[model samples]
Target: MPPHVLAATRALNWLELVTETMRTALEALAAAAPEWLIAHVDEEWFERYARRADDYRLPDGDTARTAFAVTVGRDGIALLQAL
Candidate 1:
């Protein structure tokens, strides 16, 4: 296959993985903290996250990647605290 095709395939796979992971996380959250999920998470929030995940790209450099990871970590922590 051509390089562009290979790259597109990988990106699609990554998106699928992210989407599936988010779905699983949402399921677990709904099961474990239904009240919290209902209070904090809405359909719009899910749609926004899904859109962002679909558009997500890896950071270009190490510093950018680290910052991205840190931001994601902080978001996870905030969600946990909310729960």
Candidate 2:
């Protein structure tokens, strides 16, 4: 049997809404500085991009990915390839 990779597309903001851990972090960011990405995240790699910031809230418009999360933290985006 092979490991399964469940490709789930989500808006970058959606990650902060739907995922509890993310919400906590992002909410703090929103409260403290509504214009910057928060700590607990590797902002160096993951870019915070939005077409309209608020308008790009729909997950349906995200690019399709044939990958899945590993230890999805606010720090990284890991896709399982072969393990």
Q: Compare the candidates by lDDT and give the number of the best one.
A: 1
Best of the candidates, TM-score: 1
Which regions of candidate 1 fall more than 4 Å away from where they truly are? 46-83
Tens digit per residue, CA lDDT, model 2, 1-83: 33332333243444544334434545556677655544344454233322223433333333421121122332333211210
Q: What TM-score would each prediction reach against the true structure? A: 0.54, 0.28
Q: Which ten residues in a row have the lowest lDDT in candidate 1?
A: 47-56
Q: Model 2 segments beyond 4 Å from truth?
A: 1-18, 38-68, 74-83
How many backbone collisions does model 2 have?
0
Residue 35 displacement in candidate 2 (angstroms): 1.2
1-83 per-residue lDDT for model 1 (tens digits)? 99998986675566445545555676788789887787876555454344334334545554764565555455456566776
